[model samples]
Each structure stands twice: as structure tokens, then as C-alpha cells.
Target: MSWLVTGGAGYIGSHVVRAFIEQGITPIVVDDLSSGHREFVPDGVDFVEGQVQDTSLLERTMREHDVEGVMHIAGYKYAGVSVARPLHTYSQNVQGTAAVLEAMQRVGVSRIVFSSSAAVYGTPDVDLVTEDQPTAPESPYGQSKLIGEWLLADQARALELTDGATPLQHVSLRYFNVVGSGTDEVYDTSPHNLFPLVIEALIEGRTPRINGTDYPTPDGTCVRDYVHVADLATSHVAAATAMAEGRELRPVYNLGSGDGLSVREIMDAMQRGTGHTFEPVIGERRPGDPARIVANGDAAARDLDWRMRHSIDDMVTSAWQARTAHPDISE
Candidate 1:
């Protein structure tokens, strides 16, 4: 079946694309290449170099490829940036998602897999967050995603003008800390996340920036669950397969490793994995960063029969390998 994967050349999107390809599925990629690298997109897959908000372009791509479904990974995801530039985040994330939904309806493509975030449940009272947990989005980034989710629902039910009841079903996967790399061909270009920033700092012989050293956690740093990209990729396959088999309604699932690891633990793991002794500088906290946020991914496992096979060590090691192999994230 033909599928459209927005941001398919990006880190997580590429993994999903590769996983789909391995299962004898052909996916067309739509990436504007703003933050995503072109090298991540494999040869032979249909690739559209454009943005999700480009409605005419999206319609053309879907029509040309006969796209049956869409996997929307196209969004601005930096929490700090979202705080600084709320309008831009909403425009790119919320508005872009709406456009994708409209284009999907116009093209008669039904299913979508949304890449949501654990940040939606910002600073949960408990570390392990379930999908039913209250949404208290801390930043515009998270709020925009929440808005996107609402838009997805509206699109599915055909509640708006230009409207007709759509067969469009969506599965929003709220994931946390997508780390590790299956291909050395693609490494993270943005150094916002903990893993890549730490690895790059070590390679450059500089101290890594560890935000907020005064959290209530054991190590006094914000704790998070880091899920391996490969494992998360498997779950994406599960989502696609579930929809392809005809799940009637839209569902949301949380993807996580079901554990919490602190910044100290992450530093130690990176040091061990990269054989580097670089320490991180504990600066002031990043604005809108929650104290501790982990995932209670039992719902996904229960529904999709998905489980994480890679450990935290595996995530660090794989990321370390890629950083060591290509320190600059270049081909």
C-alpha cells in the first residue's frame, strides 16, 4: 500500500520509513529539510521535498502516489524554542497539522499516525504518565500538539466546513525521548535533546549543558524515560499495521520505556559509552522544562502488543556509535 510519511527524512520519521520498507511497504516521504537531513531518506522511495502546510503540494503528492494513509511527524518540537517563539510553534505544528488533515480529506486518504509528546502531560505528579493523565502542557509546543490532536479528531468526524464525514482515523503516539540510531547515515542535527547534545559536547571537548540542577529527583536533575529509536520504530509499525487492518476509530497511545533516568545517569552512561570524561555544566533550568516526566506505556503494549526491547544502555551505546562515527552529523 502507498503511504505518505511527513517529515520522513527526519530522524524518527526515517526509522519509521525504513521499518515500513523492511515490511514490504512503500512509503512516500515529505520533508522540507529545514531540520531534517536529506541523507536520511533512502533511495527508491517516493520523496516530496515540501512542507505539510502546502495544501496544493500535499494534494498533488497524495494524488500522484495514490496515498492510502499518512503518518504526520512534521512539527516543531523544541520546548525552549516554543516558549520563546509561541506563534511560530503554533503555525508550524498546529496549523501544519490542520492542513495535513484537510489535504488527507481532499485526497480521500483515511488513516494517520500522529507523533505526539510526553510533554503534553507536563510535570505530572507521578513519573509514569498514562494517556488518560490530565494534559497540562507547559509550552506552546505542547499546546500546539494538543491543538493538533483536537484538529485530528474534528477531521475524523468531519466537523468543519469543506467538510464531510471522513473515514480518516488517527493514532496519536505520545512518546518520550526518542534516542539511538539504526543508521550512521543519519544523526540528529538539532542539539536540543539531552543525548545528542551530550555526545556532541564530548566530541568537541566541551562541557555539556545540563539544564536545572535543582529538581526534586534523587540526583537533583529532571528525570526522563529514554526509549530507543529502534524499539519505538517497532511500535510505529504496530500502529500502521493496526490501522491498515482497519481499526475503526482514532486512538491515542503513549510510547515510553516505562522507567526514569536522571541527567547524572545519562552523563555517566554517555561517558562510559563514548569513553569520554567530559563533564556537563549545570546551568539554570530550561524554561518550561518539567521536573520529571516518564512514560507508562502499558496502554500501547496492551493495545498494540508493543514492548521496548532495548535498554537505556543500548540507547546510549547506539547514539555514541553514531556520534563517534560522524561527529558532525554529516554523511
Candidate 2:
């Protein structure tokens, strides 16, 4: 049986599919090509071009592929943009997740690994945000993710109430500033992300700028966790493996580096990796900017084999390599 990965044609989803292959498992891809590339699905993999919101299509794909589990990563994932498009965010993330759960229930697929986000924590007060902290999402995208988590928890509870029904085992992975390219074939293409923005500026002969250099940090810049995409993909596969093995797993896991790097440090790495030397222009801090927000990944480390395997330099290097490989990306 194969694991169906929703949004399998997207950047992170593509990496997850590759990781499953590395673990000697089959992957079935389902994507609508909305913000996902068709070329990223890899040859020899079964792909169904459709949205997760279409429950009938999802059910059909699951049944046809003999799907044993699902990696639900399809969603409208831009947090800043979601502020302007709240309805669209809820429709894609909230409604889309509900449809996936319903399809799983119909097909008796008992395992799911959700792609959650650290945005659910908003501007956290603590330096090292833990899973136990209360969720106070400041944007619609974050609220949608938190609500998706609630939907899974509620479904699992409801399934337990059904007599003689196999319990729905699921885990939601909260991602924090996912960066780096695991493979040259797949790299982040989001317009609003940091790495892409910085790389695009340098390629276009413009200086990459940092926002708010007066933050309460050693570098006078905001500090945030940046995990390598390859490492994140491996943990996602591990969660699926544990579920397939009938091993009890936690409800949620945060993929993060316990200590994070600053924006200035990231700029330095970009310069070193891309061989570009220019002083970054300082700009006003965006509203709701947090001085620092790293997460404690010890729980995920103990359970999901999560670790900071790649350094900041490694992240910048791999990302630059991928960016250069695709000559037209900056254009």
C-alpha cells in the first residue's frame, strides 16, 4: 500500500515524497497545480491532479492507490498574505483539511500526518517556545492550522466513541521557518519567504535588506529558527512510519532548532554562500514582528529522530545552489 501525499507537487511536499522513497515506501501524489509544479512529482510515482477539497476525488485516489495513510500538506500557506485573504485561507486550509479527514473516514485510512505551522503561536513571549504554550494565532492562516489540529483531535475522539472502530492515529508537525533545498530538483518558490526574497534581490543586482535592526538581540535583529528542509522531510516520513507500525505517537511535534540564528547572521551566510558582498539596507520592522521565537525540539528529537543536521551555512549554500540551477527563477 502507498501513502497518499496531498500537495505532493509543492516544494516541501515534493521533499516529503522523496523521503518516503528513501525509506523504501510507495507514494501517491495528489495536487491541483495551484502553487505547485507538475515537474516536481518525479517520474514513476502515481499522481492525481486534483484539489484536496474535492472529497470524491480524494476518496477515489485513496481507494485506487490502496492508500494506508495520508500526509496532508496541501493548504494556502502564506501567513502575511492570509491577513488580506482570510476567507481564502479558511477555505483552503480549514475546509480543505475537513474534506481530507472526511475522505479518510470513508476509505478507512487510519493514519494521517498533518503539516501544521509555528504561526499558531503568533508573537510568543518566551525565547524558546514549547508545544505546551497556548496557541494565540494572530493571522487567519495560523488560525486555520490550529483549527485543523482541532479537527483532527476531534475526529480521533469521535472515532474512539465508535464501538469496534480502529482509532484514527494522527500527528501534526509544526514547522518553524523551513529553509534550504534538500535536492537541486526541488527548492522553495514562495514569493514572500526570506531565502527566496534575499536570493532574488542579489540576482537582480539589488541589496537585500533587513527590517528593524533595533530589536532586543545581540545582533540588533530579529532571531528565528530555520530548519533544513531535508531534515524536516525525514521527520515527516518517520511520523508516517510510526503510524504504519501501530506505534503510539504524540499528537503534535515541532520541527525547529533549539537555538536560532539572527537575520544578520543569515545575511552573512547568504553573502558567503552566494559570493555576494553588499551591506544590507535596514528598514522599518513590520508590525507584529517578534524579537525572537525559537522552539524546543527535544520532544520531536526523542520521538521523530529530528535534529539540526544542517548549519546556517549549509542552508544558504544548498538554497543558493538550487537557485543558481534554476536560472529563470529570479526573473
Candidate 3:
């Protein structure tokens, strides 16, 4: 049986697709290509180009492919942009997730792995965030993700209450800042993400800028948890494997490194990795910029084999190499 991967042509989703294939599981991709690239979907994989909100299309794909599970990753991911486009964000993320669940119910698919975000925590109160941390999402994107998690929980509970219904086995992986490429075939292309912004600036012979430098932290810049996309993909596959094998798993897990790197530190890494020595420009802090937010991943480490297999240098170098490899796409 194959697993349906929504947004499988995107960066992190593409990595998850590759991980599934490496583990001998067939993956069928459904992506709208709004923010994702079609070429990112590996050759030989069955791909359907359509919106996740297309319930009939998803149902047909699930039935045709004999899908056993779903990896729901397609959504409007920009937190700042979501503030200006709340309706569009809700339509794509909240409604999109509902459509996926609806199709799953119709097809008797009982497993799912949700792509959640640490934005659910907003500006976390503590240095180390855990699954138990209070959720106070600050943007439509974050709220939509939290709502998506709720949808999965509610659906699972409803299934448990139904007689003769296959109970839904699901897990939501909350991620922080995801960077690096699992393979040179796909790289981070988000214009809003820090890594890509910096890498793109360097490639275009422009100096990267730091948004906030007066925040309370070493080097006076925002600090955030950064994890390799490949490591994140590994844990996603592990979650899918555990569920398929009837092993118990948590309802949600944070895919994060306990430690964080400051913006200045990241700039230094960019300089070292890319052989560019220009200092970054300091810009006014973006509204709602937090001082720091890192997550404790002990639970994920124990249950999902989550670990920071790549160092900061590894992340920078790989991202640079991958971005440089696709110069035509760089903006």
C-alpha cells in the first residue's frame, strides 16, 4: 500500500518522500504547486497536481492508490504574510486539512502525520519549550496549524467512538526553523525564511541583513532553533513506521533541537561556509520579533529517533551548495 504525501514537491515534504522511498515504502504525491516546485517530486513517483481542498480529487487518489496513510504538509506557511491574508491562510490550511480528513474517512485511510509548527507557541515564555507549553499562536498560520492538530485529535476521537470504524492513528510534528537539504536535488526556497534570505543575498552579491540586534541574547540578535530538514524527515518516516507497526505514539511531538543559534552566529556561519566575508546590515526589528524560542526534543528523541545529525556548519554549507546548484531559481 502507498502513503499519500500532500505537498510532497516542497522542500521538507520532498525530503520526507525520499525517506519513505529509502525505507521501501511507495509514496504518491498530491501538491498544488503554489509554493512548491513540481520538479522537486522525484521521477518514478506518482504525482497529482491539485489543491488539498479538492476533497473529491483526494478521495479518488486515495482510492486509486490504495493509500494506507497521509502526510499532510501543504499549507500557507508564512506567519507574517498570514496576518495580511487570514482568509487565504484559513482556506488553505484549516479548510485544506478538513478536506484531507474528509477524504481519509471516505477512503478508510486510518493514519496521518501532520506537519505542525512551533509558531503554535508564539513568543514562548521559557527558554526551552516542551509539548506541554501553553499554545498562544500569534498569526493565522500558527493558529491554522494548531487548529489542524485539533482536527486530527477530534477526528481520531470520533473514529474511536464509531463502531466497526478503523481508529485513526495520527501524530503531529511541530517544527521550528527548518534548514538545509537532505539531497542536492531539493533545497529551501522560501523567501520568508532566514536561511534562504541570507543565502540568496550572498549569491546575488548583496549583504544579508539582521532584523533585530538589541534583543536580549548573546550577540544581540534573535535566537531560534534550527534543525536539518533531513533529520526532520527521518523522524517523520519513523512516526509513519511506528503507526503502521501498531506501536503507540504521542499525539504530538516537537521536532527541535534544545539549543538555538543567534542571528549573528548564523551570519558568521554563512560567511565561513560560503567564503563571503561581508558583514550583515542591521535593520529595524520586525513587529512581534521574539528574543528567543527553542524547544526540548527529548520526547521525540526517545520515541521517533530524532537527533541533530547535522551541525550548524553542515546546514550552512549544504544550503549554500544546494542554492548555488539551482542558480536559475535564485531570486
Candidate 4:
């Protein structure tokens, strides 16, 4: 059976799609090409260039592709932007998710792997945030994601109570700070994350900007767990397989490297990775960003058997390789 990947042409979405293809699954993609690049879409998969909020487009794509499962990853994903423009974030993350669910109900798609975020946890008091952590999102972006997951879980439970052939089964994978270059066919150039931005500053003979230096951390910098994109892709595949093999399970798992690293540590490691030295200038902290954000991956490991292998050095080195080789992101 085929799968549907909303925002399948985006950086993270493209990697997940390629991961599915590697497993011999040709997923049909729905994207508006807003932040997603058309070139990132692999050759075999059907790429429907349209908005996820468009019900007609979603229904048509699902029906035409005979989609069995949906890997939903379409949404605006910038904390600061969401803080600046809450309405836009709500429209894309919340409304877009609702639109996809409506289309699935219309076309009879049974399962979905909703892409949630660690932002939902905001500034948890604990060092590592667990799946059961109380959601207190600081930004509108995080709030939108948390609300979307709630929407999916409630819908699933409501459907399960009814007598139906295939109840809507959904799995929400909340992740943070994804890093790594995708396959040769898929690469991230203009990444908003630190990995690509650091690489960009290195190649340009400029120091990477450190958002804060006064936070209560080892180096007074914000700390975060960076999981490899490939590992995340594998986790998505596992989520799909779990829902398929197991009778019924609607759960949420946090996908992240349990080990936390501070921004200063990351910059230092990156300098070592690329054999380059550049100062990391400390600046005013970006609003809504907490001092530290790390995921508690125990739930995902127990439930999905997911594990992250790539180290920070690997992430830095690989991203540098990609950026240096293809500075223009041409093919």
C-alpha cells in the first residue's frame, strides 16, 4: 500500500520521503512549494503541487494515489516567526492539519503519523522532557503543534468508540533540532537550523552568531538535543509499521538525542569537524527561546525502538560537506 506525505518536498519531509522510498515505498507528496523546494522531490514519487489546506487537492491526491498511511509534516516551523505572526502560524499548522484530517476522512485514509515538535514542552523544569510533560508552549508555533496533536488524538479516540472497519490511527512524533544531510537526491541548503547556518558562516569567513550568553548553562548558552534527520526518518517508518502490525495504538513519542549539548559546545565541535576556526559572537537572545531544550527519548525507544547514532561532529561535518560542495544548492 502507498503512503501520502504532506509537505513531502521540504527539507525534513524530503528526507522522510526518501527514507520511505529506500524501503520500497513510493509515497505520493503534497506540497505548495512555499518553503519546500520542488527539486528536492525524488523522481519516482508523485508530487502534487498544491496546498494541504485545500480539501479538494488533498482528497484528489489521496484517492488518486490510493494512499494507505499519511506522514503529515506540513506546517510553518519557526518559533520567532510564529511569535511575530501568530495568526499565520495558526492558519498553517492548525488549519492545515485540520484540512488534512478532513481530507483523510473523506478519502478513507486509516492511519497518520503527525509531525509534532519539542516546542510543545517549552521550558520544562526538568533537564530532559518526557512525553508526559505538561505542555506550556512559549511561542505560537509550539502552541499550534500541541493543539494539532490534541486534535488528532481526540479524533482518534472518538472514532475508535464507534463501530467502524478502520478507525483513524494516529501517532504524533514530537522532535527537536533535527540535523543531517539527506540522500544525494535530497539536500538542505537554506536551513533555519544552526547546522546549516554555522556551515554558511564558516564558508563565508564570518563567525556564527550565538543568540545568548547569559543563560544559566555551562557556557551560558542555550542547550538543545540534535537528532539526525535520517534517524527521524527511520522512526517515522517504524511508526507506520507499528500501527500496521499492532492491532491499534494511538500514541505520542518524543524523538531527540537524549544527550544535550550547549550551543558553545556545538560551535566548538563544528569548528573541529570542518577543520576551521571562527569566533561565535554572543548576541541578544532570540525571544521565546528557552535557556535549554532537550528531549526525553525513553518513550520512543520503548515504543518505536528508535535510536540515534550520529554524533554532533558527524552532523557538523556532513553538513559542512554538503554546503561546501554545493554552495548554490544546484543538483
Candidate 5:
């Protein structure tokens, strides 16, 4: 049986697809290609170009591919942009997730691995965030993600209450600051993302700017958890495997590093990785920016085999290697 990977052609989704392929599992892709590239879907993989909101299309794709599970990664991911486009964000994330779940129920596919975000914690007051942390999303994107988790939980419960119904086993992986490229063929194309923005500026011979430098962190800039995309992909695969093997799993897990790196530390790694020596220009801190928001991934470490396998240097080096190899990313 194959798994349907929504947004399988996107950066993190593409890595998840590769991980599934490497493990000899068949992956069928359904992506609209709004921000994702078609070429990112590897050769020989079944690809269907469509939005997640189209329930008819999703049901057809699952039925045709004999999909037994889903890895839901398709959504509008721009936090800053979502502030201006709240309706569009809900349309894509909230409504779109509801559509995916509806299609899953229609096709009787019960297993899912949701791609969540730490944005749900919004400017967390504590230094270390845990799964039990109060969710108080500040942005439309974050609210949408939290709502998506609720939809999944409610659906699972609904299924459990149905007579002769198979309980929907699912897990949501919340994370922050995903960077680095698992392969040169696919890189983060987000216009608002930090790593890509820095790499692009450096490649174009322009100095990258830091948003703020007055935070309470060691270097003044904000500190946040950063995890390698490959490691995140591995945990996704592990979650899927555990579900398929009938192993008990948590409803939610944080794919995070207990310790985090400040923006200054990231800039230092980028300089060493890209051979750029220019200092970053500091700009006014964006509104609602948190000083520090790291998470304890001990739960995932024990269950999903999650670990910080790559350092800041390794993340920068691999990301730079891919960025340089794919010069068109700067375009």
C-alpha cells in the first residue's frame, strides 16, 4: 500500500518523500505546485497536481493510489504574510485541512501525520516549551495550525465513537525554524524564511540584515529552535512506521532542540559556511517577536527517534552547498 503525501513536492515534504522511497515504501504525491516545484517530485513517483481543498480530487487520488495513510504537509506557511491575508490563510490551512479529513473519511484512510508549527505557542513566556505548554497563537497561520490539530483530534474521537469504526490513529509534529536542504534538487523557496533570505542576499553580493538586536538573548537577537530538514523527515517516517506497526504513539510531538541558537550565532555559521565576512545590518524588531522559544523534544526522542543530529555549522554548510548548486533559488 502507498501513502499519499500532500505537498510532496515542497521542501520538507520532498525530503519525507525521499525518506519513504529510501525505505522501499511507495509514495504517491498530491501537490498544487503553488509554491512547490514540479521537478521536486522525483522521477517514478506518482504525482497529482491539485489543491488539498478539492475533496473530490483528494478522494480520487487516494482511491486510485490505494493510499493507506496520509502525510499532510500542504498549507499556507507564511506567518508574516498571513497577517495581511488571514482569510486566505484560513482557506488554505483550516478549510483545507477539513477537506483532507473529509476525504480521508470518505476513503476510509485513517492514519495521518500532520505537519504542525511552534507558532501555536506564540511568543512563549518560558525559555523551554513543552507539549503541555499553553497554546496561544498570535498569527493567523498559527491559529490555523492549532485549529487543524483540533480538527484531527475531534475527528479521531468521532471515529472512536462510531460503531464498528476503526479509530483514526494520528500524530501532529510541531516544530520551529526548519532549515537546511536534504538535497540540492529541493531547497526552501519561502520568500519570508531566514536561511533562504540570508543565503540569497549573500549570493547576490548584498549584506543580509538582522531583524532585531535588543532581545534578552546572549547576543541580543532572538533565539529559536532550529532543526535540520532531514532529521525532521526521518522522524516523520518513524512516526508513520510506528503507526503502521500498531505501536502506541503520542497524539502530538515537538520536533525541536531543547537548546537553541540565536540569530547572531546563525549569522556566524552562515559567514563561515559561505565565506562572507560582512556584518548583518540590524533592523527594528518585528512586532510580537519572542526573545527565546526553545522546546523539549524528549518525548519525540524516546518515541520518534528524534535527535539533533546536525549542528548549526552542519545546517549552514549543507544549506549553502545546496544553495550554491542551485543558483536559480536566488531568482
Candidate 6:
């Protein structure tokens, strides 16, 4: 029995793939390679080059690999850019999720773990975001992820209504800012993520810029919860194992650090970790950026063995080492 990981060629998905292997579970990867690197997929793993939106491809892959569950991580994940590309975001996230669900139903696979986002709680009023927090997404990307969660719920409900049908055992993991690296083999390569952006600037002998320094925070910049990618990947494995063992789980869990770090503080850490001492260029706040958004991971810790295994320095140093190790892939 194997689990199919959508977008397993990408940064986060690739780490999850390795985590599954370490736990003695087989993983089949399906990726379109739009933003993922083929080399990121380890050797000997079954990989299908295709979009998750293609139901036939997903169904065929599931049957071919004897897939018992799915870790759906493929989506247009840029929240800020989604403001200008709502249709693209919805098509990739919402429609893609629908296709995955359809394929699962066709193959009689009843388990899924969706990669959701904290953007679902747009500028949450509460200081510490919880699973019970009301969702008010600000960007199209956030809305699309929220809709993806809805699709899972709706599909499970429909299955429940069917007689003699196995109920869907599913969970959605809402991630905040996922940083750091699980292994030098696979690191965060996204041009949009903060860690890579800053690392790229340092490597190119350029000063990184911090957008919006006048926010209502101690550092006057947007504060966000950051979690190590390796720690995050472990939780995915935990969730999958829990479902396979018939353990009950909440519909949603936030894989977040209970605290936050401002963009300026991140810059400081970057300088110390990368040995590039330069003041960041202050820029105007990008539209739709929340001042601060941290989350409580108590539920995930209890159910999914979640915890902050790495410090900010660990996140920075590991990311730097991994990125610098792959000069050919660095942009």
C-alpha cells in the first residue's frame, strides 16, 4: 500500500516524501513540475508527470500504485499574487481539489490530508489563532484554500449519505510560514517565500527589502508564525499514520508556532546566519498584508505530534546551507 503525494517534486512536498520514506511508508509522486524540480524527487520513487486537475491521470496513478491515501499539496500558493490572478488561483486550488476528490472516489480511496493555509483567517482578531477561529480569507488564494477544505467536508458528507460506503477519514493541515530544510537534498526553492528571497539577495550581493515597516507591531513590520519544514513534514506523516490506524482526528489543525517574528527580526537573523550584514531596504506595505498572525498548535501537538523542533537560527542556518549547497539550482 502506498500514499500518493501531489506536487511531491516541490519543496515542501518533497520533504514530506522523504519523511514518508523514513517512516517505512511508500510514496508515489504526481507533479506537473510547473514550480517543482524533477531532480527534487528521489530516485526509485514512482513519479507521474501530470497536473492534479486531471482526474483520469490521478485515478490511473492511484490504481497503478495501490494508493491507500493522498497528501494533496499541489496548488497555486502565492497569496499576494492571487489578488491579481483570482481565476488562476481558484482553478488550481479549488478545481484541483475537486478533481483529487473525484479521483479518490472513483478508486474507492477514503483518506486524504489537505495542505491548507493560515491565510484563511484574514487578519484574525484573536492574537492566538485556533482551529475554532472564524475564517475570513482576504485574498483569492486564501478563499481557494478555504474552498478546498469545504470540498473535503462536502465529499465526506456525500459519502456518509451513501449506504455501505466507507466514510472518508480526512484532515486539513493549515500551515503558517513554512521555512528551513529537512535535508540538503530538498530545500525551500520558492522565489516567493521569505527565506529564499532573503537568501537569494544575500548570495547575489544585494540588500533584501522589507515591505511595510509601519505596521501596528513592535517592529513596525508584519509579524508571522514560522515553522520548520521538517517539523511540518513529520506532522503529515503522523496524520497519515493516525488515519491508517483508525484514530479519530479533527477536521482541521493548525501546524503553527504559537509565537511570531517580525520581518525586521527575520532580517536580523538572516544577517547573523548568512554573515551578510546589510540594512534591509524599507518599502511600502504590499496590499492585503496583515500586521500580525500567529497560531496555537496545541491541537496539532496533541493529535499529530507537532512541536517546534528548530529555533529561528536553525531555520536560517539550515536554509542557508541547503540553498548554498545547490548553486546550480539557485536563482
Cα RMSD, each candidate? 2.0, 1.4, 1.2, 1.8, 1.2, 0.9
Residue pairs with clashing backbones, model 2:
none
**lDDT per residue, candidate 3, 1-331, as tens digits?**
5899999999989999999999999999999998889889999999999999999999999999999999999998988778889999999999999999999999999999999999999988898999999999888888999999999999999999999999999999998789998788899989889999998888888989999799989889999999999999999999999998999999999988999999999999989999999888999877545678899999999999999999999999999898888877644
lDDT of 4 by residue, 228-328 (tens): 88888888988887887864554788987888999899889988999988888888988778788888888788777688878788877766666676656
Residue by residue across 113-181, what tens digits does model 2's lDDT show?
Answer: 999998889878888888998898888988999999999999999999999776899999997688999
Candidates 5 and 6 compared: the better one by TM-score is: 6
- The C-alpha stretches of model 2 lying farther than 4 A from their native spots are 287-289, 329-331
Flag the better candidate by lDDT, 4 or 5.
5
RMSD (Cα, Å) of model 4: 1.8
Best by TM-score: 6
Query: Which of candidates 1 and 4 is the stronger one according to lDDT?
Result: 4
What C-alpha lDDT does candidate 2 achieve relative to the native structure? 0.91
Best by lDDT: 6
Task: Give the runs in model 1 whose Cα sits over 4 Å from its true position.
Answer: 159-165, 248-250, 327-331
- Tens-digit lDDT track for model 6 on 105-166? 99999999999999999999888999999999999998999999999999999999999888
TM-score of model number 4: 0.95
Residue 250 of model 3: what lDDT?
93
Residue clash pairs of candidate 1: none
Report the C-alpha lDDT of model 5 over 132-166, residue by residue, as the tens digit.
Answer: 99999888999999999999999999998999777
Query: Candidate 1, 205: how far from true, in Å?
Result: 0.9
Number of backbone collisions per candidate, in order? 0, 0, 0, 0, 0, 0
lDDT scores in order: 0.83, 0.91, 0.93, 0.84, 0.91, 0.93
By lDDT, the candidates rank as 6, 3, 5, 2, 4, 1
Please report how far candidate 1 places residue 223 from its true position, in Å: 0.7
